[model samples]
Target chain A: MSAAGGSNPEYVIARVRARRSALFGDEEYRKLVRMGPAEIARFMEESEYEAEINALGSRYSGVDLIEYGLNHNMAKQFNDILDWADGRLYDLIARYLRKFDAWNVKTIIRGIYSETPRDEIETDLIRAGEFDDRLISRLLDAAEIEEVVELLSGTIFADGLEAAYDDYEDVGVLVPLENAVDRAFYEQLLDGLVVGEETKQYREFLEAEIDFRNARNALRIARSGADLDPTDYFIEGGTLFRAAELAALATNPDELVSKIRDSRYGDRLSNALSDLEEADSLIGFERALDAALLEYADTLGYVFPLSVTPIISYILAKEREVDNIRAIARGREAGLPPEEIEEELVIQ
Target chain B: MIEAIEPLMTALQSEAASGPAISPSAAAALAVGLAAFGAGYAERGIGSAAMGAIAEDEDLFVNGLILTVLPETLVILALVVVFLV
Candidate 1:
């Protein structure tokens, strides 16, 4: 309990595990998919999101209420993680949490590029990263993408963003800058950790994540038959696809699936891969990847009980809950059928 | 090197005649104190983990308290050495 006693993983994990248990079960999602937007909000108010839903209810309604509640709960859960962690534990958890920074930066740049209002952009940011309020406010206040990049001057994202700004100019597209930010985030994710037995396993887990992301990107490119270069979207650090291999494999769906089937992730993704072969729906396959990641994270939690893996696993589950709730609310608002909406929810 | 402490044998004779400044009972008591220190050190991690669980659920307080004191069994066993001595 003493602040001076340093990191309390036990307390954090205990609370996290309790919160993890409270996430919406599969049955809840099934019931939620059948409800309307107002009904979804009502359901949320009775769950772990009650505080967030009540707090944001005055300003937003229906799907917006669900969206704000989801984002707020996401921020609160992650911020609690950072607050609980200390020493090297803080360092490890914060590394993964930088995804929010990537998300915030991309949102801001896209908003500024499209001239969306600052207030709207600010609402979307999950303030759970290493970035403080001052930095985020500065980013919001910036009138242009250049100014936004300049505002982030000394952060890890600065250099890559600055470089991508040129590519953004040449093509007049936001893809370059977004890719730069994503590349920076993943690059720094596993950078400079002390090598040990447990960390080695953690490293492999991260690499698997990167590999899955690359596969998703490649599959989308191949399926969409986009004229854009697949290599450009290829993120480094994944063991599955080298950058050059993406270009050739991206043109042929059968070869791409075969290559993935032979790779390290083959075992974890066999069912999803088979589904892709049968149904030819990349969306379902992507959802399968997400389920596989969730299951893998759960396994990692039990293997390294007191390590960073459980903490990350909890984060994933919480994020999934928020996403599922939002999907139900949005699906209801959009008048999508219950069964279709239920398909969108990744319950596993 | 294997001469087996002739100087300490002579010192012991002289020292024992002076009725030994530190008795075996005192030595055993010191052992108990060190064992208690070891028990306290072991309790540190368990105690923190217990408090953590208790904080999440009030119902766990009793269980946490029980687990926290489990290491005290070491010190209790160390007490047996005092009686033996």
Candidate 2:
């Protein structure tokens, strides 16, 4: 692909930077937390989501409209990035966007398991992944889990899901199947990732993400005091903890704290570890991870302005936007006050 | 693409090997023209990127225009070449 055409990283980065600056910052989320769902949707309609809002207005209303608009805007913005990128940029961006594909696949499988209608499952899908319409349509048409696995034959999720299907049959739970998909995606993300000066930095950024995710999962399992194995949920390629280490640490919260305190991420996550000790809150730890990821992305962007880091940073920020907006909308609907709702958002 | 430059390189070299490539005025003109070519090449990239930015947000028009011509200083420097030639 790189041989067929040269990429314009500088040009694309310039445009991406412009778009990045337009993403909502802390103050915006704070204000958004103060508004009701209708007000939030109105605010979105007057912002970058205007077109999506207007288009989905007739089909949905209130929080549903906001939800649809958010999804629509996410798809559109990501599609625009794909449209602008060329050659290797396209490849790099596609690598990350496939996360959504993993998300959609999980959603579909869970929905099918719960016996949801195909159309309803389809509505939850974000079509920003590399999966073409035909593939998705075939997936939607699948009548059974076996059929779904068969339909996914050519995709990255195929083999993993096939194996997981066996475990699913034996256990009669979807954990194995869903985990297979997540592992497949994460494994593929770092496969064959040769790095240059710039992409090296991008690789590091990605590792930070992997590390944080593993940490979050470990913390969740640790907090729940569940009997399940932590290694069962371990994702590869993170620089922090190994599967065995995480499995061991999952059983002891204090030891996990000391382990995290001594790791390379210790400095960045110190406050979170303290909060974990004091408030006994996983939310604080999760927010700290988010903040750390955002800070890492920011640093990476400056270090490699013309590479994939900025694009990845933008993707992270955009995802955060969708999450924050959703949090605000849901919080309002649940009758939570603005300040309490704001606590649920991660705006940095 | 590279072959195009080979003949031009030869022509320039042959002219210089002569008693003089041209009169001082003509030599200066050549210098200015070369500078202008370089500037234009630089502008091609900047201008396209600037236009892209402007298309996304209209407020960038002035900043884009300024950046597009930043390389024009090369041509202005070549103006001195005109006098020296």
Instruction: Give the TM-score of candidate 1 (chain A).
Output: 0.93
Residue ranges of candidate 2 with Cα displaced over 4 Å: A1-7, B1-41
Worst 10 residues of 1 chain A by lDDT: A1-10
* True-vs-predicted CA distance for residue A223, candidate 1, Å: 2.8
Per-residue error at A137 for model 1, in Å? 1.0
| lDDT (10s digit) by residue, model 1, range B24-65 | 999999999999999998788777777767766789889889
Output the lDDT of residue A141, model 2.
84
Residue pairs in collision within model 2: B24-B85
- State the DockQ, from 0 to 1, for candidate 2: 0.27
Q: What is candidate 1's CAPRI-style docking category based on DockQ?
A: medium
Interface Cα RMSD for all candidates?
2.0, 2.2
- Candidate 1 Cα outliers beyond 4 Å, as residue runs: A1-7, B1-23
Weakest 10 consecutive residues of candidate 2 chain A by summed lDDT: A1-10
Tens-place lDDT digits, model 2, residues B1-85: 6899999999899878886746778777888999999998888778767877887889999999999999999999989876665
